[model samples]
Target chain A: MSDALPGPTLSDEPILRVEDLKVHFPITKGIVIQRKVATVKAVDGVSFTIRRGETLGLVGESGSGKSTTGLAVLRMLTPTAGRIVFEGQDIAPHRGAELLAVRRRMQMVYQDPYGSLNPRMTIRSIVGEPLAVHGLDGDKKATREKVAALIASVGLLPDMADRYPHEFSGGQRQRIGIARSLALEPSLLIADEPVSALDVSIQAQVINLFMDLQERLGLTYLFIAHDLAVVRHISTRIAVMYLGRIVEIADRDDLYRNPLHPYTEALMAAVPVADPEVEARRPRAVISGEVPSALRPPPGCSFHTRCPRAMAVCKTEQPFLRKISPERAVACHLHTS
Target chain B: MTRPLLEVNNLTTRFRTERGTVAAVDGVSFQVAPGETLAIVGESGSGKSVTALSVLRLIPNPPGRIESGEILFDGVNLVKLDDPGIRAVRGNKIAMIFQEPMSSLNPALTVGLQVAEPINVHRGTPWAKAYEAATELIGRVRIADAASRLNSYPHQYSGGMRQRVMIAMALACAPRLIIADEPTTALDVTVQAQILDLLKEVTRETGSSLILITHDLGVVARYADRVAVMYGGRIVEVAPARDLYARPQHPYTLGLMASVPRLDGGGGRRLMPIEGQPPDLASLPPGCSFGPRCRSIIPQCRTERPELIQVADRHAKACFANV
Candidate 1:
């Protein structure tokens, strides 16, 4: 199996590296001059790296901090603390123009097609906005041609550039969004639940488009989604985020085939199978409780409340991400040395 | 054997749009025997929801209408009935669970009141009696601490819980047939399994037929006894669940099965995605709607739309090449 499609070698040098990334929103108290009462830690001390030209899938249920982590990676949200090393430079200290330059290299494709695209803007202008913003508006005709080509590249009609976003369907609008993200030729693309909004049939088309674009343009993708099926289809490596931290990280096949983390095992078991016989045979590991609130997550392991195999140690001591196998890293007392 | 609970014959639903009249459900036909589960599978605009709505005669008349069809429930055609006649049967004889519990359930009303309202309206039972019935119904659907949850509003319940409440509400009257429209689509996986299991169990206990409408083949495989695959407002394939999954005779059904990322098997090859998007319902092609995306489409497929032909005992496919 390895001979047919060799796994991409893991390199020490990563295109984008996030260490202890935290995004916390303050909950205020008074009417006048609000005092910070508590913080909702959307993403807390999460760390992972995306190698050049590799797809890293961030997967979890809603409010698992997967989307927050993706937004933090793009600098769309201000991280309270952490180091974001993009390419070779550290972006934590970068502000204003420096941050703007770094943002140009990292683009985001939002989940909702209806909400993301402006109804007022035509497809051409929507795609061309990034080009115009990046100080590439010198030749309007060439830019328009490029926008049309980008539209075509994402499997949309070239003439769709003239139509308004409302004129197109959900799938077509998503294609426009993809085109807009690619207008600047960004090195890193963070797609946050991009295909979740579309129909199951349309999801395949868009996922294929992502793969084709990645191969054709040598793009690195940090694909964030709750849909494990879609995640397994596109991702090279997968990071399982729970509450506000990554619980597991491994190659896609390795993670799917043999998940070490109990949280991951439960999640995989929960995925519905297409075949009835297989679904009946598949043992379901039902997590007992709902995910704890991020405002005040469980002290040690955020998943301990819902973890089926939660132990006494899982309550008091936080588990660090340690290598369970050569291909997998799991943060659980069960796997800890 | 008992008579089939619900039999829909040549059901056609249409809506008057700003552009023109649109036929959403075009000549669809199927049946759900007592205690059986029938799944109507389709993508967006395939009229799966419309067909379900038409059965209850809930299609808004100003724009939407059941142009032609016979929805026979226990040998009586629901299409021929007046508003009052249909109203008598809607909650008393048949009930429906919508896709989104958050939207379907009345947010202003308490969960108990919402579930009991059907009993109040249909049976003309006292409010207190109906409310007691509602609490009992909640417990029947497996909600923990049903008595406490009865006073809670729909917003207070989580997505899965709200869906359970919806199921509880639908089953409160113990209707002959329960029409569940993508009941589990909005739920997480574990919750989905639980909901599906609950529905299956409750239906079994009551001996009620279920019409499960969803786009997911996976959900159908788990819950459905019979499956109907819809494409461009038409039933492209209809078969038993196991038969359809094993040997999909229609090109559209086969494409849908192949396109989905399987939870079992498949060692890392990229999913074989259907080439093109779904056809524009307003401007459908001359022949088969799936012809554009079908891998093995022949020249004849472009000229004539194939009618469903029986390929096996209970399996049918609407494709010339496969038949």
Candidate 2:
């Protein structure tokens, strides 16, 4: 997983290209003189491409490092290794001013709307802060009008701009967060589980809002979520991650209908659909054990320990992402020659 | 069916706030048969948890009160039971599992001690015998190295493993009914499936009824034998799991099911989210609480509230326009 190269790229020049990205956290056991004892490979050799104006979903369980990947893509967490090419520029190596400029066009919306927002700040200030940070603030009156407009776009009334984050419910708080992310009108948005904290009915509203925003703004999205159903609804393409690596990447419908990787298949099967009849009939794909810790992952294939179809070769050699179809790629020994 | 193991009727629980008294669970009623899994599905403020809490008589006194309800267990009204009388049944005849295992389990005590508590208090079993029973209980929950792990504290296990400890504790008394509120909401999907399957397995093995409170309809579909959908502190719909999913009679239920994305595939329509936010419990709208949000609302919906009426052999809903 650590050595994986840039995965198969979808043609037509993607807006964001993540190649062999690795974000590792050092586990140091010292106070004054701290030394790295071990490394937790949070995002190990994961790669994917988001076509312009299309949403590429990154799906995985909690420990699979999907959030880490999103953070690295946003340049919030510096990757230990790899290239993040945004709009034809490898922004991964950029520093200070260069990074700041790149960040103006790439914003992130966090999972917990409450924690992500400042409790003390009003909605107007929260949404307009991004504009001020990016030097887009015109004047007091102009910023107020712009904030109101942004708030209206997310379906909240303009008067709500005067209220604090604590005054609103979870769904409305998420809307305020969305308004803030849309403040700069970033070309590429990384929505990290934006709807996970919402109630089911409210979740629909936020998800539909995302689709509408994408349509109107024509923005590329790196939508990261653990819920497969919601991901399928919003994303055009999906990358299934297993222990910090993309096990499979394919078009949304294609991946759902014909998952090639064992991990992908298991993930798809593991999702509990909302229909009892379908659930009763669907074959349960039971992966035997829990995901191994990222600090000391498996030798060859990270998913080998829990994979139902593991082989002797899977334990010895790490398989490269092999193409089974034009738009589908899976990194599993069963799919590899 | 043989007499329902648990029957609830006209259940109304209220909470006192600075503003006013809020009717959290308003005139809700349902039944759970022995060995059956009944899922009470709802959004965050829909009072599903309140209903479960009221059943267990676990609500905090001054701020919360079961205003009026008949929680009949084996033909006796639990609401009328004395404190000592109810304590005998709380963990012995009925057990409860909470959403987050971390908060539910005491960090100061060992896993074995926590699980053995019901046996120690109710059955009056000696500490040594209780611990022996607890070791067996943990093993039954499929926790590997159960005997050794008994010494481990709550923080020592993963989310999934900690939930196993909770389940082991709930099953310690072989209770006739188990009330699990969002049991797997905090765990990963794979672990969720595992825990659910284990919950279903153990409950069936002991012939105990389960009342599963969850927000995820997927979990309901997969785990529930029957489902009672709650909205605005009332039962909007109740039916056998398959029938409810097949032909939803309530507009709220229909909107709720349709609003969620489908892994199998979506309907022709993109998700049509419910129009408004969840109702504020303190001052709910006069008529139907769902009227403001429901799509198929007629003029009368805003003037007159609906009542749950029989739709089929075991199905009922409270919506007037949807039918």
Candidate 3:
């Protein structure tokens, strides 16, 4: 692996390490020659590490930049600053075939299964494409067997491999996508809202498939989603993002039981409980107004405008992540180091 | 209970799909009392939306038709009402708020004009007088700058604000029944909370019956007085919100409750997902539609259809379980 900077040795390296990552899209103003006027800091100075064989769930509302951060970590989008050290190498500056080589061990499963897969391609070829791309298609017979196994692993029949993408249900389509990701046997997978599009029953099936795959393959995952319950179900650790920054990150149980950040508190409260009696009794703290415009985010704490516990310091100076405990980190002034 | 504001009896709506004639909403019956909130919970293709549309007499013809039903709104059959009679009831006494506010509201017109429409059509009030009422209604829904917002188009409002405008329109003439179809589904979670809070407060204050059609079980649990669980275009179970959650009778209902991951702060068990896909409506089985996926399925279930039988006071389930 080519290193943008000399990273730590492989023996000591976490599976994935993101430090001060920033993904800023330049807003251009021009008809013909576009000039950069300003930048939308979709992901600003976010950092986290996913150890091997563990699932780190990245969760937030829309425009929270969880998806952008996922894309940036995959090196699909170039980051403006910071380091994305995968294994023993910094992937920030990787480009061309070097990046593709690095990506062979890291894969992404998209949200929209219907749009992500080629409608014209057969399920066999769809899953087998990664093998062909990685030049493992010399033995066609062996490749076909591998594709069949992956398809069956995702709970789809090998017989359905020859069928087109449109022939299956939404849940089935998502399974095909997951199977394709497994074709490379990637050690790390970035699944972007994998089951949110699926029905409740089907969603459970797919979510279980992910959990099963993780255990069987020992694959680490960066699971990005907006649903809190689903995240907590599968994730070992959960990171709550608010306006391009991580507001909180803790063990899944700890995060749910006691959230330190006010934004995290509101995000958790906003989720309606499935049990009527419990929901009726629970007092919900409703966060006023929509997420502030990401184009012109607030100076101090991006959330202070709508935050219920906003203080005078919250309006002027930014509060970065501070470790409240050995395992828990919160980005709120209330939780002083 | 004040002679239940609305009662639907054996309502069956069929659609002319590419495959063939399919019963989208088959033999569904329920009642909504005055000041009651009934949540119809189901996934996509479950006919929850069709049921709501059927009650309002808004089923699109040619491809869609209400084959049989008695939608009794104040002792009058809405199914029997003509175009003009139903139009008087539609958006007049029984208003609807759609899932997509952008699509529902005319983008070309100002927010005020669109909201004032019900008052003008129903009350026969002048545009100016109706606009004033619309402004008041908008204010009631807690949309800030309600007066100035009247002049703004639908595009100017945020998703949450547009939903607020939609809610304001629903409350234009103090309608006896308001049917909100996924009213907050398009908004973010925080915004969704705000809209749900606003809708509940307004509905409770006005004492109007609300029929909320949504795929979200969580929303149903929080706001619904009663819940009707629909599956494969049929009402599998209907019970008080608490009763249904506490003790789900039908297999499909139980499976649904188990399938969802509860955020109750005490859970590590794997979700026991229902094994099979929802049956296609057009090629539904002879007897119980859920028979293929049911855990407690018996031989008799595949041969005989079960009618909804009362299990307890105000609780009923249409299943052959322990009968």
Candidate 4:
């Protein structure tokens, strides 16, 4: 069934292009003056691009800067340094009203359904907030009708517009969130672990909904998640991140079939298989030690300390993101040469 | 064949809410043999966690109660045991690892103290001796620099490391059975695999039975000897790991299997998602809880609750049509 779909081809012009993105939160200590102790480098020197109608899956362990990168792209958090060119325009330099205008074309669906949705707001207000904020429609009746239609489009009942978030189940709430993201008819959608909070059975539903929406609306996606299985299901291209930087990026099949980066290999090895025979046959490369603190990321490759194939060069020389194959890019010293 | 270490027979747990008493675990039955891993696979509200919590009598009283069933551990009925008896068995004979290690471990206490507390509480060993044993257990779980890490608080440890600490604490007393409830849900794939491997290796070394409560079918195939598919508070299907995945008898089980995206599966294809949502526990339907979502559901399934009947040797499914 999957073979019928065309392979994801790279476009000459990307809808969103990010270069050397960095987001650092200041850390302070002591009571007297609150001196700066250090910085938590959530995202550092990460570069990627999302073409129109393309789904780019950003995968990594927790604190891998995937979510931070997403936020930085959306300009939710002011980046310390980077370029975010959306639709051939540098949107990073924009501020206030200018940034708001750019945001109309880009939308984000958050991770937590329980927390993201406002308890005070009904489904009508929650989904219509974007429309209200943008002042798209004047009449409340017209907005409510549009919201209802959007809800129905996402497989939710139109009558649910009157209900609160608490009344809906986790999966239903996520659909509502998706509907809210789609309310503005944005070209780019950044879904940060959109289906992570959902059940396995329901996750597939949400994922398929996203695909269906993409096909129908011609929307692009920056899908962020830690689950490789899920990323494999929805994404065309995948970018592997580790502690503040993208370690590898490639076509979904290329990355899964022949992952070059050590971290990528380790991540793939860690995914549990549902088939007993397949699991038994696969040789697992269990990386030793825990992911180091993002506050004090390793001196060189952030994953060097935990990398099974770590060498002296890995500790001193921070590898640059270089194209290993035409479609595959990796940042390990082994592939740098 | 060896006798099973833990046997759960017709276990049914209920929770009294403002709406009504909802049966969270309805007549669920499964057994875990010594040194074997039994996985309970289900989505949220499927009662997989509740079933595990019932074994330890950890279900919140007043609101939640085990209405009926027998939890037989080492030939002793845990359900019948008094507070002290259950307490005695909780950490010493049966240990548990919660879903979120960050919340499960004490934020105030150091990792060493938290892990050692189990040993001290159950065995009454000296604090110093218990602390030493805790450090050893930490090392056993593959937490590097165990001595230095022991002094660190739960907040100081990473998610994966904290989970390792939780595992260490659970194994502190060398319990006969360990009930891990979604222990790897909060962890990354790499960390989750490491934790699973550690669990499997530790359990194998100690000859302890493991009840891994999780929704991930992949984890079950990798580590579990037996798999029990739960839905709407009932065991819809239970079979050997390989057999269940290859030929799932229950429609719900098959749906779950098909829904999960395989690593080897081709790209760009939409996953075969289960049509509808999981049933609401508060207002469950008359017959089968999964009838609304089941593709193969019949009129009989909607009208009558199916009994878990043996479909094969040591394999049972709670479905009329599939069997």
Candidate 5:
């Protein structure tokens, strides 16, 4: 099933390219007259590219600014700095109708299935609402027919479209969300923790549906998640985030086998394998210390506090993200020439 | 071998919801040997949490009740304990760690006060000594600068730090058994590894058995000595951690393992998800609760519930299938 979709060729231009993106929220004090105390640098200087017909898994723990990066790419949350190039056009400065027009081309699938969908709206109305809002739906009758097909395409029966969000299970509600995202026939889908809220059994179904949809529709996905295993399964390439920085970007297998960044290596070691023998044999290189607050991040490398191999230079001098090979890039002092 | 630290026999818990009484934990049975870590693995609504709550007698009486069962902790029947008897045992002997540390820890009280409160109340230790013990436990859980941080509030601490405080509270009295319900679920992967290691290290030092309730199969593989795979309020399969992983007999167990994408590289393998939704307790199928979703269903599975029987030494399954 995976081989059915063609891999992104070198000649093809990337669908989306993010360059040194930074999203900083000013932490204000005082109720009436707020004064900016400090900036919570959420997505501080991150860069990556998502090719057409490929999955770029962005993974990190909470407060790692992964979700902020996704929202920044979608222009939902305005970037503090850097370029967001979508199909060779920088969409960072766009607003009003231009932004609305750009939104139709790309879509988002949220993490919480229960919270994302409107509880009052029926599945038919919810799915078709996007089409109507984008001025894609022809008429009421045409919208109904299109909604039915969308619902059916997501593995939900067309007849069930009349039911409310509460009537559907978590997995079903997620399918509804997927159907809604696909209503506009978008080229890019930024799915942030799409399967995190599902059961182990149900999560597989949703993932399979995602793969099937990608193969059929040739969709480009920005799959953001915290679970490394889930990310590894669905993503062709992965970017590891730590304290609002892209520490490493490499192919999924390469990242797993030869992680250059200390944070990435620690993350890989931290995730316990399912097999008992494998877990028993593997040496655990568990890193300590909690993630520092984004409000007052560490001086140099944000990961230096917990990194196993932190050099003196890592404590003061910030390391730039540089390509070690053609396909892999890492931001660490040890990898520096 | 040695006597079991805790034995739950045919435990059944029911909840009196608006929809009517439904058995959330139905005829569940398992044993946790002395110093052993037994994981109750299940998805939501599988009654894993209810089973733990039932053991501690923490279930709300109006809406929830332990319908029938014997929770034998250290050879004493916890189910037969009176109000004060259970109280003496609840925090003093069997401590529980919940998922959300923020909610579990008191926001109004200092970390030292809360952790010391249990030690003072249960052991009749002096306030000064209790505070000292609390500080030691805080240090034991690997919280840096434990003395100064003890005066800080829960909100001042991060999520992982709050969880460490929760662990410190759980370890105050050095309870013989610790029930951690999805203890690391709310934390990050790296932080989760640290917390689990701390829990294991502390439990080993105190020689306390642990009842780890979580849905992560990988966690069970690493920490648990034994595992109970629960589905629709019953133990579908129970075995040693290694045995269960090596050869999962129940279809539900097999499906769960297959569905989860492994971190150890199986990118090409397609996940074989179990079909249909989890069983609703209020209106479960007449025969097997998992009958509708069971891929290895037989005619008997639809008509009668299968009893858990010994398939191997220290291994049991509640399925009729030959697999």
Candidate 6:
């Protein structure tokens, strides 16, 4: 049993740690000898950590780099600069066989269930492909049993494995996607807006399924979404991004109750509560203006342009992500000074 | 009481498909008083958007048509109007703001020209006067430097700005009724708040009745004076916004409210999601549309469809269960 696990294994070590991660997409001109005109800093200097079995939600609107950060962590998109340490190993520079071995422990669940599944393959084949690809397909009967168990884990019937993707509903398709991602038995899952495409009534079912899977499997998650309410439901801690930079990161309940950054406050206030009484009692402090382009983000603090409480310093000097409390970090001049 | 600004009675809209004639909006009825905001809330294939298109007669004739209904606007039945009569009403008395602003506006034309064209056609105003009016309309929707932006194309403007231009065109003639179908769904949350606030403000100033069709329960709670919950092409429940949120009568409404995770609902609360898939409009069930999904389903619900009946003042529900 001890031979199966040979390394300096620490119980308190984070399952994943991302430090100063930057994913800049270059805009070039000309077809031949293209010259870089500008750089879109999609994920700039973002940092966070996820303990084993904890869900860290990354939330932001369009062009905020929430999706880019998730991709960079998975190495699907190369990071311009940073460290993505998974289980104490910096796999940022790994490639080919090294990267493939590391990727076996990390999986990503996409946002669009309709486009993610293969139309030509059956549900059993789609879920079992990963097992076969990793040389785990020992025999026909064993592989079929494994696929059936995975399908049943997501609350879908085992017999549905023979059906195609199009035959199932949107919610059922999303469950199948989850089942396929879990086939590898990865320790960390990066779910990017996994339930946004489903119907309102079905979104809750998927969310509950995610929580259930996490508890039963002891899986860590990096949940990226734009909806604050949905993020709050499943996250242990949250990181709020704006203009490709993380403006605030705190515990789930603390962040919602007392948001330090102006952008965080504005984002929360903008989400209309379902209860009319709560809506009436809440303040109408909707921040004006749209998100600035990532190619030319506002100088100093990226959110200063739309910050309701922006001061002179916020426009000229950048704010660093500094720890204010044990479980909170904020990038705002108002709190720094 | 004063007559409703727009009254739709038993409006049934169907589309001819390869499978069969599918009733997209089945016997739906609702009303909107002057200056009031009525939000029709439903998910995809619930017929909320079809009802809005039916009101304006924008449904394509070959594949889609209004089978039977009475759309009365200021005492005149719009469903019975001739082609030219309907054209006169459109943009002059009732204007529609579509969900996608990029597709709705022409890229070849300037913002000023598009906004002013309705004024030119409806009232036959001179080009100079119409341009001036268009500038005012754009400014009313909170677009800065409206005169300067008139020459800008739709491609030059951002998504939020493009939507503002769509709203300006809808208000060019000061239409009595404005039907906006998910106007802010494409924009971000903060931008969505700004757009909805501007819409409410401009409509209030003009005293125009607004029919907002959307699937977001949160948006409906904040902006709607009255709400009509739709399911499987029928109006399952109707009530004042406050009452509906306070006490949702229908089982579907109750399930929907419970399913959504609220911003203020703290953390760790388990969501009670309604079981079963959304109804298939092509092959709907025999009786109640929500019977299979209802938590408190009664025997009568599976045998016969229920009609919306007034259970309280301004509150109605179409369910046989005592929920």
List per-prediction Cα lDDT, in the order shown: 0.86, 0.90, 0.90, 0.88, 0.92, 0.91
Report the C-alpha displacement of residue B125, candidate 6, in angstroms: 0.8
- TM accuracy, model 2: 0.96
Residue-level lDDT for A290 in candidate 2: 79
Structure candidate 6, residue pairs in collision:
none
Candidate 4 chain B minimal-lDDT segment of 10 residues: B314-323
Misplaced by over 4 Å in model 6 are: A1-11
Per-candidate iRMS values, in order, are 1.9, 1.6, 1.2, 1.1, 0.7, 0.7
Please give the fraction of native interface contacts (Cα pairs under 8 Å between A and B) kept by each candidate: 0.48, 0.75, 0.69, 0.83, 0.82, 0.74
Order by lDDT, highest first: 5, 6, 3, 2, 4, 1
Q: Relative to the true interface, what fraction of contacts does candidate 6 keep?
A: 0.74
lDDT of 4 by residue, A1-337 (tens): 1111222244467788887888999999998889998999898888887878889999988889999899888889899888888988987778999888888999999999899999999998899999989988799788878988998999987778899999998889999889998888889999999998888888888889999999999999999998898898899899999999888999999899999999999888888877999999999889887678898888878788998888999898888787666566788898765
Which tens-of-lDDT digit does each residue in A1-337 have in candidate 2?
A: 3223233354577788788899999999899999999999998887777889889999999889999999998898899999999999998988899998988899999999889999999999999999898788868788888889999999999888889998999999999999999998899999999999999889999998999999999988999999999899899889988888888889899899888888888888878999999999999976656788888899889888888888998898887776667677789889766
Q: What does candidate 1's lDDT look like per residue over B1-323, in tens digits?
A: 46778888888998999878888998888888888899999999999999999999999987998988799999999999988999999877899998799999888999999999999999999999999999899998878899998999988988888988988888878899999998888876767867888888999999999999988877888778999999899999999888888888887787787778875555356666677778777887878878888888899889998888889998888888942
Q: State every prediction's TM-score relative to the real structure.
A: 0.94, 0.96, 0.97, 0.95, 0.98, 0.98
The TM-score, computed over Cα atoms with residue i paired to residue i, of candidate 1 is 0.94
Q: Could you give me the TM-score of model 4 versus the true structure?
A: 0.95
RMSD of 2: 2.0
| Candidate 3 lDDT over residue span A223-244, tens digit each | 9999898999989889999999
RMSD of 4: 3.5
Per-residue error for B174 in candidate 1, Å, reads 1.2
A307-327 in candidate 6: lDDT tens per residue? 889999989999988877767
The reply for model 2, stretches above 4 Å from the true place, is A1-11, A139-142, B266-269
Q: Least accurate stretch of 10 residues (summed lDDT) in model 3 chain B? A: B261-270
lDDT of 5 by residue, A1-337 (tens): 1111222346987898888898999989999999999989999988888899999999999899999999999999999999999988999989989999998989999999999999899988899988889887778788888889999999998679889999999999999999999999999999999999999999999999999999999999999999999999999899999889988889999999988899999999999999898999998999988898888888888899888899999899888788877678888999888
Indicate which candidate wins on lDDT.
5
List residue ranges in candidate 1 displaced over 4 A.
Answer: A1-11, B265-268
Error of 5 at A71 (Å): 0.3
Runs off by more than 4 Å, candidate 3: A1-12, B265-267
Q: Mind giving the per-residue lDDT tens digits that candidate 3 earns over B1-323?
A: 56999999999999999999999999999999999999999988999999999999888997899999799999999999999999999888899999999999899999999999989999999999999999999899888888998999999998999999989998998999999999988888889989988988988999998999887889989999999999988999999999999988989888888888877645457898998787799899988998999889888899999889999888999899772
